[model samples]
Target: MLRELRWLMAGALATTLAACSPGDTELLAPRATARAPGRATTQQENLQAFARVYGYVRWFHPTDAASRTDWRALAAIGVAQVRDAATLDELRTRLVELFGPLAPRLDLWIDGESTPAPGPTPQGRDTMVYWQHEGYVGTRLSLYAPPYGQVRVNAEGPHRRRFTQAPAPDARVEVELVPGLHLRLPTVLSPADAEHDGEAPLDDAGLAHAARSASGYHDLDVRQGAVIEVWNVFRHFYPYQDTVEIDWPGLLAQALADAENDRTVDDTAATLWTLVHALQDGHGMVGHREIAARGRLPVRVEMVDGVPTVTGTDDPSHFAIGDVIEAVDGVALAPRVAHLADRLSGSPQWRRFRAASWESLTGPRDAAATVKLRRGRRALEVDAHFNASEPAQPPRPPQLHRFDDGTYYVDLTRAQYEDLEPALPEIAAAPAVVFDMRGYPSNTHKILAHLLREEENADWMHVPQVLAPDGHIVGWDPIGWHVRPAEPHVQGKLTFLIDAEAISYAESILGYVEAHDLGTLVGTPSAGANGDIVRVDTLGGFFVIFTGMKVTRHDGSRFHVEGVQPKVAAAPTLAGLAAGRDEVLEAGLANARTP
Candidate 1:
């Protein structure tokens, strides 16, 4: 089961903006060892801390002043200044400088604002230190109002303290009071705070029950729980956030209303699906579990000559390989595909592929679908019944194909790492090799090692870090994936064959290949959904896995929406399939064999 996470941190403004002040440090560096006052254990930790402060103030501050500021620019610029911070005090100084401009607008600073005299003092009930609304996980607040005597505080300062030990009933303590000023600290949710297991999580059946219940669906807790969870974790602004139009708050409100009115799980799923479509994210999924269990059409179809054609089928009624589908259930295939594009995520090519694929596999289960087909020059209509049974598998075992021309072909989906290990020497010595990535790969790293140049540092990936919990991408930080190819690195041309099915790990591995100029990419573009995914369970048992990071090529070009484009793009044609040819493979082979 995939677990959800909660972030605990405060937000603040940066103050290190003066020309006289030293420049910001390199926040993007993997490691930094500089030392100064108030130093965080690591530079990354310091950035995280800084981000928390920035976010807390920018988003949660009582006043709207922080909202008006250029926070994005503040973070971008402040990261550079803080890189040189040797101590926490030094980091604080930078923060003061960064926030200096907004100081007047914010009432957060203690008068004279200088660092408080080092250490503790006692005060009475009227005086408070700091206050903010407490945080919550799912629906559970972080606050635990234990028996009065159950907790104690280590007063670090008049306004700063730490939990020490359990206190006795009616325990009274004193702290030095700042004259004329004080702050109340609200119970804020800690990073370790978890969603309470109060109401048992709904199972699939329970989910269906909830969806159909007028009272349960309209219940505030149910609707808010779903919205809050998504708001806390969804990386809404990655890759295409700037281009995609999404009014997140508005959608949440609409979803709540829709959920209340929904009469079935499918209706609720459709509402949730709309929320995903708003972002145009390839990683978007809402009700996959229930949908996947619904049986699909027995035949496999491919987009050929811009038309969906039957490629293979075990239970052939009227459908046969090379039969071009013109329409389904009275709807024109092309127009239906175009209309469904909004519901699918990724680039135009990926959208087309998914839409066509969905149409090929979709229909009323146990009922017949009328498919209009054009087999060569003849047009025919047939009632095709979806296969309720599991799809059949090939009897012959998976193996690598070694051609007479000395080129090797391997379908990564069917082949394993061990299957390729024994042939590494010959594969390296061959004139060219083709890696068919038209399906999911069981492994990638080990095979990738054979293609990468040893000790090469390329801009291969990016991961988003949460500075605050606003349910949106705050920053996309570039990270490194250094390559060190195994002994006897392949000297021959490497060709990667990809299509709509090549996704996630497939697209990720392709990033390194394309970035380093390691091979030729032949075949249609990929699914364009490549990133580490974080799985989320909605109000009902519906599961959604979204891209948790922003991935890009070395050139900083995004791979999330615009998948790695093929150097030589080609699609399988019906004529080629009819003649028993793998056109995609042939294209790759031809490209490799050429000068």
Candidate 2:
């Protein structure tokens, strides 16, 4: 079962901003127009221009008209409206027509035209309204809390003036968005008055009506719009923008091109998958039910002795334990593994583990394929049936296990707080204890209380506070776990087992243990991705999930792709698997028994 992070931060600013200097207003001013390349020659180029302008107006423009509009529907309608323009002037007219209603102040012109001057600063109102974000995760963010806000700033107060605003709608400050297109969308304005703007605010009824009338994923235009929407969200709000090395603009161009050629929903999904894979984020996933429900081989494969070896299976007729899978469907398993890995997002170990485990053998639902396997000295060809339903697994062991030697073991992956609460006395009294974290854990992190001697606070996750466009993080609000000591402290020697499957909340617990020297870690490095997930449903049919916050080590070292490493490294071997031994767990047990 997947555990969702439910805690949310609600308060005023956590940090103070330095006073803005008069000269700092230049940061908000629009840039001068660049030399025009020529008219847009392709549909991709026109859509690219539309995407840039759409993001600017949707996120930065602060008018009530823009706020209440159904942005997803508008994106689809906008794509259909502007994608066929053959010249720069045509594109400009379409863009203005599409966005001018939502942002009445919006202006667009050809590159060589005369540039518009800045609007005069307001005379009476001392407060300026601008955007402030604590954890901007796109449209789906409202499900948790409001991540975006229109903050009121006093002109004479001590605050960062990173964004400049035009005083009124008539201001014509222009900046070049693409080679041939230039745009002017004011970032600041006076309070929106529907009567003054000559356009009534879109009520809930109108918003719903617009959404019903707009195009959906069935249309190629809407699919392209979805790509643009997703690309802009990551480009501007992803927390790890500085950590991950991604050619964002190039990626957007490629995604747009791929979407243009997409013939089926699956093709669009694959395109989106490739785009998210570049983040290398463990939490990143494309939410498509059909794709997710694809069939899987019955055997559980893992890298053992540097080969893809089957470790677990209830049906031995096809392949027994310790069988090396050399090829599937005539393709070598090595290249297939690499190909599957390339489409996933995560740290190197995590990606490789997933690719080698189940993804390499996955195919269409209820399909049968030939597998070439080596059982010891004999090579055999077998027909492997793909189970559309989840593969049957061995029965789970007791959550709390006890050995004859007075050592206690708990599988955090299987044990919840309720199950372990009754066994705390036995666990605390034992001479040694081992905790297995080889996979995602239930709500078992609270077990930390019994292991700690005092209150411990691990403030490792930082939520970005964005005040400007293009991922400009002005500040960060830290969020983390706070554990307090409880009765019946576990005096026994502690050991933890971990591997690449341990991610997010698992890493969070391990990070605390490593920082406080509370236990001994044994096994391979963890998955290396940690942070609460932020899921966004696009105007398109599907939704995207990704890390919403930035995470670091307790002492402020990089931890995005560098998960917690164990002091004692160990992995399963072919010999161990054939002998039915859990080598990693044995290693942890060995450490627990020492001293």
Candidate 3:
């Protein structure tokens, strides 16, 4: 009987996981646990049930009560009230007791019982109220505004009456379809609260206090609430829900279970990190001050010959270029890299690159680090020091360097568009040009204008017009930059140096290049995530940032995990590092020199 109830609850949550399709019963199956009967598993199940309903009421219930209530406080209170529910009946009663005030029209019942009929539609209202978002970023500050216009159609037109009158709220009802699943049907229109309307702006101190005073820092309810809040946000608004291969219901269940065991702020952060990492979004991150402030070694590492090899450094006395790192502070290099990579979100290459570069080298500020290195068959132990902040790299090569062979090398990663504008004539006259894009670019996309012979409209980003819950895209707003022809069209061959570090804006420029065949891309494929980021603050003070829009190739094909692939594959070699050679740049130069 208990097993049957668990399966029913799983089915209910699965319906809410992604409303675009039927629930995957296999993926949502209850975990096979060998542990003795305890509250841990029960609390996980309870929270999962609570989260399913929480999303419906918080986003879909159009009432003055729900609009005006403090959602963060409600999440904490709801988690506390429902975490110990022993049966489906108890869960239904507790949900009603907690949400009845906000959602007077909410209905829940067992699958075998007769369901309640919806309230009668209000007179003289032909259209139902529902949510329509042009681009729902996130609510960080009441005064915070996006550069691009964000429109919430819920507060405009006939929907405005739903928030001011009780009958308008009572005209529509949210019902449970699969016993535990609570969602408004597609035919029903349920308006969301006005985006950040009437909310007072939170100053830094106010934000801190609000985070601390929300059921206390150590409270398990608060921890679980944090997980619930973040999970629901992604469950409903994440653009790549259909594109990625995550087990959504299982992910929520595991996150709630992990939150149950959280004892410290770091532990809670880890749980949140794990949740976000499953998205495979390069922009995904959990912001915690302590973790951000950790010290880093003053050297850059990369995978060379399948080993962690030092490639760049500010402190050469402790480590040299091409030195193979075997271990760090008594932990094997492979395990350390794996641990960091597991928590990072992105394509395989990007995750590995980031983990190897700086994340694995981070430790307490000003702490001593013991590193084991292999140099020319000699194994040596070296004591290294961590910097209080990210150590500055050695001075970059000239932004625009003219090679002896009349080839121009432009470092887009460091060269500002303003600085490069005047040099366009010089670059155009060169026999060939190599544009370095191994890292994020500095608004140099403007250069595309000079390379083009005519106007080109490349609509690469698709902003979802989310109307219902669970990321139902009613439509998409196609958006991208436009480029027009300018003076001094480059007669020289063009080549772009790229690697996994190239992401977001960098990928945008590369996407344009790929679409127009403007240049030959050299080096490895870029990070497979793109789109403007949206940062959502959780009740527990930790915030998560992820891609808020769907970015695609110029031809409108999928571009999330498949990033911009290179036409010519190249990577740095240990021997090249030992000899102070930039192999990727060399490859770009060679490609530029061709034809």
Candidate 4:
């Protein structure tokens, strides 16, 4: 089962501004080592390292794919890169080259009024240096082989600290405390998102969540670079906002008018969610709380040639596939979609590109009245009951089944935790458990904890970094998590399942299982949103969330947006919800059933 986590880390101007004085050896690295590590690690090491970092960049980087997959494909390129490198320094060079090539594709993902002029990088240097949050730079770690790598933070920091344990073959310890300060979102304040500028006329630091020095993976401190990444996501502001001037009420008014005029609450939510995602703060988000209790449309629809076409859903009586939607209750489809497109297009956050995030704009829209549809070109109206939505929660509950063939399956959401609980004993009776966490957990920590408990420890949780509003750094120290903390379940052998829906906290759950050898993962990578997600209200009532931390595995793999990969990858097929049909689930079951 999962633990409910709600601890906040404390941040102060002193802690955020500087972790330690130069007199002490602050966990950072000293000057140059060998320029090249010609005999460091293997090619797999390089590939895995680069691949992991690249995955983290998927959510954090500000560019798009070479095609409409602008973000995905660009992130995928990191795979080929690590496979080709011979040494650590070479890895760094390869990354520079890889990102450099993406300069032209920049506009494909960048959100701005006009494309900037063609020019060399801002530094005028041959090598392209990445702008992480704060003053952090993406550079090489001499400790590894050539084609040097990224994310080895031991190079230089506010102070120098030494390692007590031996370094791994691929490990090059380094750290650097970035200069300047990070811009915390308005959520940390009492009014929460009062100003458009992160620091709008707020004199009291007590009201906000302050940025503080990081309590790293083990003993490392890479906090500043994290804030830097959070600050410039999607290039909301370049060079950094020297001064703060946020328009609270104005932004809220715009968001509401934009959302209500569009017709569907889902559309509006996606627009705001896109903006929060741009910031890349894991904590930033917008979701409806009603999807769990309220019934879902039996009809599944997708936009085809700018029209709503039925895809699939649980409801059998609704309609057949390929049926075009004419209207909802009494509303028409074409006009509504057109208007929605316009409203979404008007928002700078959602319009800058085309991708999964962009493509999802048309789905699960709220229907105030019955919807009308054109099935197979025949006009028909489908009544979809709708209501005013609440806030975001995990996913809705899933259907579960236990086959006499020694297999178990479930489609779970937060609401279904109780119903699912009574069936656990039956599930455990199966020869193998095919645990599916393809997405975020519906419940905060109930169902997960029930099925997977062998032991529980407090170490699994996080140390909150409490902050004040107004962008002032505050000083606070670290301790292990105070809440649902670390408690590992060493019970039954498990095989986890996933798809695109598996993301963020769910990904973290997957990682925990993988790291401890609890089970074998089978599926595609998850939605890597495993940071401290903060949901803050805007000036009036608008709310937004963004990714916050730069979380890497204890071993250094990244998970910003790129998901976790399964141990045995399933070949994609056309099986629709059948047990013997889906390769991903079958593979997971096979792995679970194995000795």
Give TM-scores for every candidate, taking all chains together and pairing residue i with residue i.
0.62, 0.84, 0.84, 0.41
lDDT of 1 at 321: 76
TM-score order of candidates, top first: 3, 2, 1, 4
What are the runs in model 4 whose C-alpha is more than 4 Å off? 1-275, 281-283, 286-315, 320-400, 410-429, 442-493, 547-551, 554-556, 570-587, 590-595
All candidates' lDDT scores?
A: 0.52, 0.71, 0.70, 0.37
**Candidate with better lDDT, 2 vs 4:** 2
Number of colliding residue pairs in model 4: 110
Stronger candidate by lDDT (3 vs 4): 3
- What lDDT is reached at residue 435 by model 4? 72
lDDT of 4: 0.37
- Model 4, position 34, has a per-residue lDDT of 23
**Per-candidate clash tally:** 50, 1, 0, 110
Candidate 4 per-residue C-alpha lDDT over 109-214 given as tens digits, one digit per residue, 9 for 90 to 100: 0111121221222222111122122211222224433211112112122212111221111111111111111011111111111111211122222211121211
> Clashes in model 3: which pairs?
none
Output the better candidate (3/4) by TM-score: 3
Superposed model 3: Cα runs more than 4 Å off: 1-41, 122-127, 139-217, 391-396
